[model samples]
Target: MQQAPTVLHVGWMSRAVDALVRSGAEVTCAVKPADAPAARTVCARTIVVPDPTRSTDVLAGLARAGLAADAFDAVCSGLEFCLLDAAAIAGDQAGVSRALAMRDKFVQKRGVRDAGVRTADCAVLDETGAAATALPSFPQVLKPLDGGGARNTFLVADERELTAALGQPEFTAGGGPWLLEEYIPGVEFQVDGFVEGGELRLMSISRYVQNLIEVHSGGLVAHIVLPPRTHPELYAKVRALAETAFKALGHHDGVFHLEVFQHAEDGEIVFGECGARVGGGRTDEVVERAFGVRLHDVWARLATGRPSGVTSSPGHADDKVFGGMNLSARPGPVRAVPSAGEVLDRPGVVYAEVSAGPGTVLPDTTEATNLRAGLAVVSGADEREVEDRMRRLADWFAAQVAQETSDTAG
Candidate 1:
């Protein structure tokens, strides 16, 4: 009998752990103390650490747990913040460099651009609040060097807006070394897939309903998966760009979530950024439903150095379109909201998770797209139908929700 591979998974991803267990791997999870309870449920062992994204903390926790570095066949993380730590603990030098490049937007863009890929002109703003190089054009984007979920990201139209935005605490208090890039005017899209041995294994593309930065100003954060059969030319162009960017960034193996832009006028593809993990916001569910690929399971297999066992099924290449949305609400004291069961009962709604209910104080939506009132996945016969369903769902949910007014606030 063969022994199952042992995996050291960092962070607390319930789905990743479950997939690893289902793959017959002996999984041990390292997570923050607060997540230990949930980690304990799916993993054979759980090492509670103060911070799972810190390699030192994770290594020390593993030592305290009596688990040697060599005991595991792989070290992996599904969280963007923990990717570098996982790679470092795994002792994979190449993987560490790849993680670093992916985590730091400045490094990533420099490398990709040097490799002859078209990317936004960018400069690094160091601790002194000064750009390493001259600033880009008037319309520029400012974001954390290692940020995700579009948090602390800003689009400034001019010097006034830039100055005002920079005054925010996130830029002033120890948040040095930000990335300022020329704003690319185009329709944004995301490509999700797995790569192995420096080769593109599988890929899927989805067009965003609105640019993520717009989410800070009350725009909907939603997207519909584009079927390969329907958008062959688009898939080809995006795949070409993604393959080039992935190779340039040295992302040899792992699941990747890449964002790119299609030039609004010239239709040229421009690389935005990439992550060494699955895309967030119901991406895994939408991809599986549209392409018949379970990304979590694929991640597990790739992390364990096993074949991905993922193959595009021609049968799934029908006209059926799938989409996902991060339900949003205005900042206020929530009065009433629908339950997950109620949302699931709606036609065309395949998956629903209602995170906010009555009494939940919804914070300002400017923080991140992940800070949602709820999330839902819908399916339709085509893109138009899926989009309509998404709008209807959003409107219906908003109408059902009531926020407490000043007079009602006791």
Candidate 2:
């Protein structure tokens, strides 16, 4: 334990490398050959595998990188799609089975239900059913059994809609297995939680202003913590639900992100899905800004078998955030761009980044990939300040697009 623990991180390069390195871990990444350059810039060493999604292939490549059966102290994957592979490999390193349970949606969900955690009723659908009698009810959700975010995730109202959804490019491209579930109608919330030494601690919960579907469909992305006045009760509910999921999945170590819903009709809380990794989006950023402890640090320590390095912070931003928002330019010409310099000048603005320049072409707001034009990670004196700043920044972005488009038309 005196030496820096070597961590073999599987999947795409991400902020995790920096966090683990800062924690004194020697980081080596096993990534797709195409991602080797980016991974090398961040990771201490890189091992390029032909296809990172295939666990067996990655293990073969890791062997080529001189990775032995006991080569590393810990193993993990950053990308959701690669978690399954990360887990399979982690089993060789950690000699544990936490990886498989959390890798497949079908397996993960069934485990939860068997353990008595409430989840959306679901069925595995590997092939399309008769269009006339496909669903037992309307408003069913169809998604890949192992995909993340809202990729090919569709809410269908009836049989005709089911056929239409099945035909969409996203669904068809998901390839192979699928899951159809009763659409849970409720207030959606994403929870970032940690489980260490068999104990589950809810770290951050951000309520989404737009359901993931809307956010992924291309538009604005926003998530804010609840005011402390209502946080205690809400936090308790989310924590209870998360703990149940952690135990059900045998998640004894590391961090997890849980997707949950508060049923709008029955006022009951239920699970949507959960990840054995940090939830995507600026979640890690929001959690760090609000809490002051970097999530990456915690994850690295956990994966490397080191004690946690985080000092817990207030559930809600003690004095900082109303929430965080990512502003996206609509699909079109980026004739003009907003100045991050001006945004920094605004009071209560904690962080901001504008990713486009004049003549930068923007794709139509249709997915998370296109939401990167303008991004703001905010923390203010209070909720009102955060809200007002977000609105103002959003307006400036819209105005920039409008004026640019008008000039072009003229």
* Candidates' RMSD to native: 2.1, 2.9
Candidate 2 wrong stretches, greater than 4 Å: 91-97, 130-135, 171-174, 216-219, 227-229, 311-316, 333-335, 369-371, 380-385, 401-408
In TM-score terms, candidate 1 sits at: 0.94
Q: For model 2, what is the error of residue 404's alpha carbon versus the real structure, in angstroms, after optimal superposition?
A: 8.6
Can you tell me which runs of candidate 1 are displaced by over 4 Å?
A: 1-3, 128-133, 311-316, 406-410
> What does candidate 1's lDDT look like per residue over 1-410, in tens digits?
13589899999988888999998999999999899989988899999999998999999998998888767888898888998889899888988898888878988999889988899998877753464234846788888877777898888888778888888888777766787899999999988888977878778888898888888877788988888888888888887887888888888878999999999889989999999888998899988887788889889888788878866432354767888898877778898888999999876899999889888998787678888898899989988888888888888887777888642865
Q: Which ten residues in a row have the lowest lDDT in candidate 2?
A: 363-372
Question: Whose TM-score is greatest here?
Answer: 1
lDDT of each: 0.85, 0.72
Q: Count the backbone clashes (under 3 Å) in each candidate.
A: 0, 2
What TM-score does each of the candidates earn?
Answer: 0.94, 0.88
lDDT of 2 by residue, 297-355 (tens): 77878877787765554455555664667766666777777788766666666667777
